[model samples]
Target: MLRKIYIILVHTIRVLAKKVGLLSLLESRRDRQSLLYVRSLFSIYDVDDMVQLDLPWWTFAAAAYVENFLRSKNGEANVFEYGPGASTVWLAKRARQVAFVEHDGDFAAVLRRLTEGVYNVSGVLIPPEINPRQALVAPSGRVGYENCDFENYVAAIRDAGGPFDMIVIDGRARNACLKEAVKHVKPNGIILFDNSRRERYRLAIEQVGFSPLRFPGLAPALPYLEETTILTRGGT
Candidate 1:
């Protein structure tokens, strides 16, 4: 299939980049370890086959960082994520409870199937409503949703009962999600914002009080470098 071929091509390019020393720019120990961990996973499974894996489909470096952070919480971390996928399973293994907010019904069913018997995990489905032409733009001003409004999708966390130890913003209308995330995360909690290199998202989070620590590197199944920023609320 076309998607499978694309995945192979991207994985080839990443291997080439690693060989040519482009990946050497990330010389930190943790960064190198993260890359190695992802490489180990790829050795056992195809790049396109990570959906069934227990790893988040994020930058390898960010995944490692989050793993360590979650481990430090002693199985007591309460996590809330905007998107649901492999991460829901991954977090449920480490955290006390993980509540993932999803906007698609079909995918929510798929996730529920994947998460069955994982009693500590729950899904909140808040589908995006169609909006009028003039109100097509998301609250964060991002366009191109074809009139989909994610206002309720972004605000669903408040109703999900959080002051969570960590909040992940990787779904639609991220700027609006980040603004709302600021209110729901515990004072010392962290926010994991995937693809933070986007200008609108970067600017929005920068304006918030959390200090950002960004990890840029290859991600599972994707071509080119991706950045995942972990922002800690309340203090430098």
Candidate 2:
């Protein structure tokens, strides 16, 4: 009971700090690294438009890392994302092909519109359904992976020409998505899981046996710090 209360208090404080601009002030005091990163994002996209549209872009640090890494790779590398949004635009700019699966039909339409002129991007909608009895449960008792339509979710991507060079698991049933991703990703490909600080996901990732490189820090447009982990087969 006390631990839960402490957690709630900490979250509330963070929210308050972000709302009052204290978080931004603190970040500035620490360094201009994050600020510079945000500026770089503006070179590729309009911040106001993205914020208004509510698209999911990686945190500033994560975005910079991914952008740099993808630029260094072959231009023909294909990418698959479990969730589609701003990251789709970001990936499309750097990769040869970008495909994403969204669980919301309305949002999928929005994604299509957003990427309309971008020839190499495609979005597929696979709405989720509830399942009461979960077959798998993590040690932390988080049941996100077991209560969704993950089989069809994975199938949609496979049908869309998978075996992608990069996969991002930032949407629903993430653990289940990761399970499927491992089978579909090219041997040298990488899997990026955002908000990886959650204990349940950490435990789930441990079972995957991939060497993880974690980036823990502030993200663009979000209030607090989070971790985005990069996992590759045999640490490639």
Candidate 3:
């Protein structure tokens, strides 16, 4: 109940902040820190209904919140959201049109309903029948997504050209996602990982010369709780 209360409070503040045109000027520092600490609360609530990838609720929340901030500041269009995570719903409010990709057909089947009522967002699972080599966008009025055993996702990218300005890699494969990320992500674009807790990601980010942008919380699972560490290729 306390968790719900906190969420309500945070959301209330957010609404009020936006209404009053002071969303970025409020008690945001404390609000951000306070929200991050509530990760333990969201973790127990089962975020599967929101996204197939299960991390902590606070982490997911933090990611969405930070993404909102970045989107507002940078004005990114043509975003390729690679993971089909909880942020897909959140991205609806921000992006003009988002291309959501989910590797698992079963999870995507369930998420399709959740993704509706979103603003200009397209949700499509991988392994398209027409083009088994590429991932499809949403509302194609198509059926039979055959993404179960599709391999060489990089080839799919090669087959489908993309100068995607923003690339979000929030898929289930945390550690190895970057290897595939390099193939699709544009040179000036960004690669944001939803659940960025592992040392491998940290090391890989450094090894690949990607700079850290933001890290919100200490260590929590909520979307809004975790540090939204962003890196724009070599730029911060």
Candidate number achieving the greatest TM-score relative to the actual structure = 1
Give TM per candidate.
Answer: 0.78, 0.73, 0.57
lDDT of 1 at 186: 85
- Model 1 lDDT tens row, 1-236: 87677657656765886787644443333245555444434322242234444457678888888888888889999999998777778788899999988987977888888888899998789877776556644553455565688888887898786889999988888988888898988877889999998877867988987899999987764546789999995462
The residue-level lDDT of candidate 3 at 214 comes to: 58
Query: Across residues 1-236, which tens digit of lDDT does each residue of candidate 2 receive?
Result: 86556556655665676688865665464346555444223223333345333334566566666766687686777999988767787678789999888887877877877787899987788766556365433111245534544556655777778788899988777777888788888888888898889876887798997878788886654445778888887656
**Residue pairs whose backbone atoms clash in candidate 2:** 60-220
Give model 3's TM-score versus the native structure. 0.57
lDDT of 3 by residue, 49-92 (tens): 33433222334345554566557545455566666655666555
Evaluated against the true structure, the overall lDDT of model 1 is 0.76
TM-score of 2: 0.73
lDDT of 2 at 53: 31
Query: Which ten residues in a row are the worst by lDDT in model 3?
Result: 137-146
Candidate topping lDDT: 1
Error of 2 at 194 (Å): 0.6
Indicate the residue-level lDDT of 229 in model 2. Answer: 88
The deviation in Å at residue 154 for candidate 1 is 0.9
